[model samples]
Target chain A: MTVQTPGLIATPKPRHAPALRLRRLQEISLGYLLLAPALIILIVFEILPIFYGVGISMCDWKTGAALGVEGWQRWIAPCVSFIGIDSYTRAFTDPAMWHSLLVTATYSLISVPVQLGLGLLLAYLLFQKVRGQQAFRVLFFMPYITSTVASAAIWAFLYNPDKGLINSILTRFGVPEIRWLSDTTGIFQVLLKPAGVDLPSGLEGPSIAMLALIIYTTWVFVGYDITIFLAGLGNIPAELYDAAKVDGASGWTLFRHITFPLLSPTTFFLLMLTVIGTFKAFNHIWVMTQGGPGDATTTASIYIFKQLFQLNRYGYSAALSFILFFIILILTVFQNRFAGRRVVYD
Target chain B: MNRDKLKSQLTNLGIHAILISGALFMVFPFAWMILGSLQTFHETTLGTFLPEQPMWSNYYDAIVAMNGAKPCVFDPAAPLDILTREKGCMIVRYFFNTMVMGLGTVLGVLTTGTLAGYAFARMNFPGRETLFKLLLATMMIPGELTLIPNYVFMVWFPTPESWIATALNLPNAEPHNWIDTYYALIIPWIATVFSIFLFRQFFRGIPNELFDAALLDGATHSRFLISVVLPLSKPVLITSALLTFLGSWNALMWPMLVTNSPEMRPIQVGLRSLITEAGTQTQLLLAGATVTIIPIIILYLFLQRWFVEGISNVGIRG
Candidate 1:
């Protein structure tokens, strides 16, 4: 009976059972007829393409011509001898592929936590019954809905080392200009260099350029998280808080026992979304860095894009994307298994 | 009691201080965008935070600078080596193309989504639950997996002219495809799972009494959907339309892949080209960025209520 589960209708049983049976037959056909256009498009574009992508990943595909067949045969078979997971095997050894995956993991690892923490804090602050709360909420949520390309362009201007505002302010305090977008040095290395500490390459962490992207990404998405968190905070029963307060529970205690547990489902939902979102994120990173300054910011999506568009390595790119797809699928299922159980339904 | 009130007041003030600063950080880039767009390139290079005089002409120059863009030209022999011809200010054209794409996609999504949603919510059918579950499962698939294959399909699929030629058994037709066409941009995006899901959820909320009354009046399902259901579902219709259009307007990667033509390019692509081409001309680039985002900002302003409510529903309900 709950509204959360959609697509259930309770139809009262009608008299004249034969007529009702005839009506049921009509309903079945009509239902399918209604669904035809959407189903056709999903099958053609969404479903079939996954299989097509898998096929492309296994072949020595460069361009359509490299598929090396004419007429409808091109559709059925690429006509070249099947490469049989060669591209996938090649990717396993490819350092660039590994680097991109590492970069993607670092991005997700950093931005997701920052966004969740900052979003929850802000949501709790706003939930304190402050005046002008709605206005603040709207302001915070603006960036989430803005076009990433445009917003990233704006951030690029903000991050411009020479004439950018950040550098200008830093220079006023006699701090030197840092290349926010173009710097390839890891942030840890940058922070530690003055102390004569040099971390090894593997331990350097995400590059300064990647850090800038992560910051911008966090800025863009935290609003969504905050808004969702605010909605979650709103859903907890007020009586629970009242009872806890009457039992002499302090603010932190009340939040710990009542609010946080109740908000766990929303937290879990956002975690899943943010994980998937960070992996698939492209527009802003592409605009700001284009996987540049020596591929420091090249997440897996950007890596696949470079292979497909710039290098035209169709088979390899397809293979790389399939690997990414499996990673996301596994991460999602893993989270569902491990994290979903703790969610408070109420 | 007085001390407790004072402590709570201090805490409230501290919270406000934090929230206001956070809000300022969120809005700072947008403020910088507007300021940069109005300044001269020389001033931007010199790190002048504010313009001496707001150069409204930067917008004009940004528009005019778009004239240098080359339309993506593809001949059958060299599909990969896209060529270009110099054109006029593509801002207007890009806007028009984006509008067409947005409107077309919205219409298609709403039609397909509403019909399917209605059927799923209100009617019983064979394989109903299974099909619906399958639709939901597709939502989990990362779009990157589909990108290459979809691009391949768009390029390799036969043209309608070729289809006609083959049917008529005529001499071989030119090798034409969906690349750089409206068909490539609009059609593939129309059948999104999210739209179907959104509509289905909303449709399920409508009371069954309406349906029963309509049935007693001998109204067909289609007639009932059109007359009784749609009229009452205004808010959902608007929500879906807004979302679909916004998504289409904001699309970048897909449009960039399927379209390379200057005329076919949307505002986002045009703005991206500006960034690359005007690498040093920060003022003009910002101006172009400002222009591209204005429509969405305007839309957001008027429909802010629906935007928040719809997004909130997505979080809580989904």
Candidate 2:
């Protein structure tokens, strides 16, 4: 009653589908094998350590003890011992920590804008085909490559009160030689001393030591900013400038219309990096000041380091580190939110 | 019209002068450091821009002092006990330690990071996205957070209470702590997330078709990676290696933390102690600084092109 298809011969559904799926699973397993080393290292060294750090923050750990679950005694032990949020309370309430925060903020606030502005200006000047630009670039970029410790040491010598070149120069100009590093007195305070302007102690500017650090840091990083700006400048088409010239847009107009907008992304990047770097700064502070002269240059990182290493206050240091991490995090997020929106990608 | 041209020419000359001055300002520290190294101790402390008398002996003294042999011993009975010791420098030893540690780190980072980067770039597996994100998130945490835990690990690893000696079945491990050992420096920095991330980004930019072609040609994943991916990623590898080397070479904090003995100390830490000891010897300190800077300068000169290109690409991609 029905015609049978001879060649097709009532083919049973292919039974190799499951086998194919199994082979696909095997391929994925191979993929995992390929990625396992990196993932394992990241998990151990980076990700797990952060959570471990959080756990350590809750503990009263010492140098000898293993940083295991047993070390969480400070956070968990009951009526006889438990200290809930005490370390955090100590860190947040500590006046030194607050002072450190203020110092860090002030340093970042002043240095970021100046570095970015100068970097952009330099990039622009270079882009204009100034003579010996390559030599100039190398000169500016030289500081970034210098070791931070060496540079700090050099700067420390320069800031020395006696036999410093700066002091000698000041003396030559008929100005009084001011104590640079050892002076905890702020610049504004010194300036206002001659005038009868009474300012509150807290309203004084950063200590001269901190000022020197800021200057050194700015000098070290300005070239990096300039390099970034130069790269950004390269991305802009020459036609944009050509068109602006055709429209009689010269000097300020050309920069305002064509260059600035195009360089926004680089500016945004430099700003974020500078903020993060300034917040996390430690090497120079450690080498130059050791947070000395009554904590004038004790940035958050140095404060935390002192607590952890110098004083062996593990829990408290961990808490301070977390606070710093959050401050940087919040600033980074804010920067991304605003700067990301404004950056001209094209 | 001719007068206008003259005025413009004057303005251009003024601009060039300003640029040259700025360049000089930037370069002055290096210039001074070099000049200071050539001066006598007295001349250096006097802060002369140019050395009054160039003393090549300063370099010899610096080298000898850093060798850390024949240390000056003082008796309180002698009036000149307060004078500086003419110790032979141990800088040679410190330099060796730094090189070994630096190379060890470079090897570890390159090997592990390459593997990880390849997986992240070319492979699609379970938990891949989540793991990558976790890796990125770790970068947000300040490094200080992990410092204590890592220290604890280094001090306590291979044992619960005893040092690594008892656990390793090695004789006389009880008294000696790993704190001042080179292992302390090398083990902690082996897993570099930044390098892994950098290599991953670079690898991702490589085309997928190459991998497929290699696969069609029946090459195994490992072979394909070694022959194709590694060669293709040479620029990034060199860049990362140089950065890793420089970072390890210039490391002050971790080495300062772990190593106390001068015998095991790296150059940065050694330099710190040297400066403190020779605080009065400005010329010697300058010579030490010069010695430290020379290797870096040479490396930079040799790899300048790769450095610029690598940094730009990494920065943009990151």
Candidate 3:
């Protein structure tokens, strides 16, 4: 750590090795001192809770109430019994857990694509020298910034079966009043019933209530995708587009050849994020549906919340959360292995 | 050339048409919220697009309901009395709580993030890289998993009142814990990995000559950070502050889980209760929703450039 620029400082270098060692010691202590606050908080809050969750998942803890036990003892021996891996096994075998997982998969599979497509289209349109582009971007991004609870409340009003705006618009077109939030019928079944098409239970898509949630989720998140896409679009060298145009390529041809390939990294990034986001999504769904209309919109997060908060099944809920973590991790790893290769990083 | 000009003008018009329509769809709910907040209950249930006569009273009723006060029986005698007495409304308290929480979170994050970020950026400590890598690894662990255990831990901590009452043998205070307190709300969230990462990157980009000069002047690390580095890092500070404030303000689920009393609830949870309790009072519900989000909307409008730029910049890099 000798000061190399001696002319600038005009101070004699501490060529004494002992002073340098003391300085090194001082630097180490200061570095640790600076890191102490953040490290302590992170370790206590973020890191320990994870191990604590694993421990809790292995217990038979219920409401965590004890007659005489108080303080930390409530979480330890004599109050909560140790039960190894029962909750994990239960989560695996429980039909409700599988159903919730199915609902989550259905919600993510449908909403992510819709969001990505709409976001890409909108970002592409905005990438052009359009007027009021900033206004458009701000308005679209409004939902992302606003509190989900407030927006979900508004959306719930707009989805009111008796007097909702959407149904009003539909009914104006001679369509019947649709139960936007309360309907539990699978949406594909509802849509295809008129076509005399019958599908089995497992093949049924997300319920109408779930479809409403998917739409709401798309509305909240599409703006974020658009912003990210716009950034990605900006990163593309303008020379590529100009070269393509010089070679007599039309706008569509240029986008197809140059833009899409270059945007794959962003697309893949969004895809992974969207999948993870959909998995993590709970606020709007909880606010809007509460996994309601017969568990139609019960994504795994909702189910976990219900179990832990409403039903007081703490141990079981912890196990379910671990299952969810593993699912997200596996999905991410799988995507990296299969989809990450296709990304054009350069 | 004349035909091409006409065609390009048409294309421009078409793009405007599509974008404006999309933008309208994006903003339609906010428009509806504002309009609906001023509507009569009958108008809301009737799906009226606009109110025949604006009902400004709905906002007052929303505030009263949010406060968990007894619904005022409208009397012809004192038409304006209820509005005057409504100064102690819980929504006002919720706003205060939110402000305190937001400021506390911002202060905590800036302090911790800057200190740790400076260490990571400039200091030569053993295990520095390993510790930072560990911090980043925690970001991948989904928050939902930690939530349950965090709740348990929060519940396990003794409430200050009960602990004091027991120690002094003063009175039998109601048994509760840190679940509903500000500590539970603010502490766990302050040390975010993203903020630390953001500060670290920004600090690393600063020229080394400044640090060298500061060291020559015998300035301590804290002194250098406060005097030199912090002044140079205004943009990052604002970005982090705005983001942290926004996050704490809009938080719903964690706050909902932690706080049960209307006295402790932030606006989001309070607005949530309004939805359930004001079952048929759709107008009041919309009014409450509007009241809940209007502050955020105003803040967003004012600082939107930073919001948009900061988000996109972080999105691109992270």
Task: Give the runs in model 2 whose Cα sits over 4 Å from its true position.
Answer: A1-27, A61-81, A192-196, B1-15, B69-89, B159-177, B207-224
Q: Give, for candidate 3 chain B, the lowest lDDT window spanning 10 residues.
A: B80-89
Which candidate should be chosen as best, given lDDT against the real structure?
Answer: 1
TM-score of chain B of 1: 0.86
> lDDT tens string, model 1, B246-312?
8998898899988877889888888878877888999998998888887787898789777766666
lDDT per residue as tens, model 2, B82-196 = 2333332466667778998999988888888888877777776778888777676566677788876666555554433345457676776664445777778876677677787
Q: Model 3: residues >4 Å from true position, as ranges?
A: A1-26, A62-80, B69-87, B122-124, B140-144, B158-177, B204-224
Model 1, TM vs. native = 0.89
Model 3: per-residue lDDT, tens digit, A1-346?
Answer: 6545625333445576567678778989999999999999999898999888888888776535644555545555342577889899988899999999988998888998999999999999999969888889989899988888788878988998888888899999988788989988777888888899998987666788888888888888888899989988998999989988999997689889999999988898889888988887787888888899888989998999898778867678878988888888888889989999987877
lDDT of each model, Cα atoms only? 0.84, 0.75, 0.83
All candidates' TM-scores?
0.89, 0.86, 0.88
**Proportion of native contacts kept per candidate:** 0.67, 0.42, 0.65
Worst 10 residues of 2 chain B by lDDT: B79-88
Instruction: List the pairs of residues colliding in candidate 1.
Output: none
Q: How many steric overlaps does candidate 1 have?
A: 0
Candidate 3 positional error at A162, Å: 1.2
Query: Of models 2 and 3, which has the larger lDDT?
Result: 3
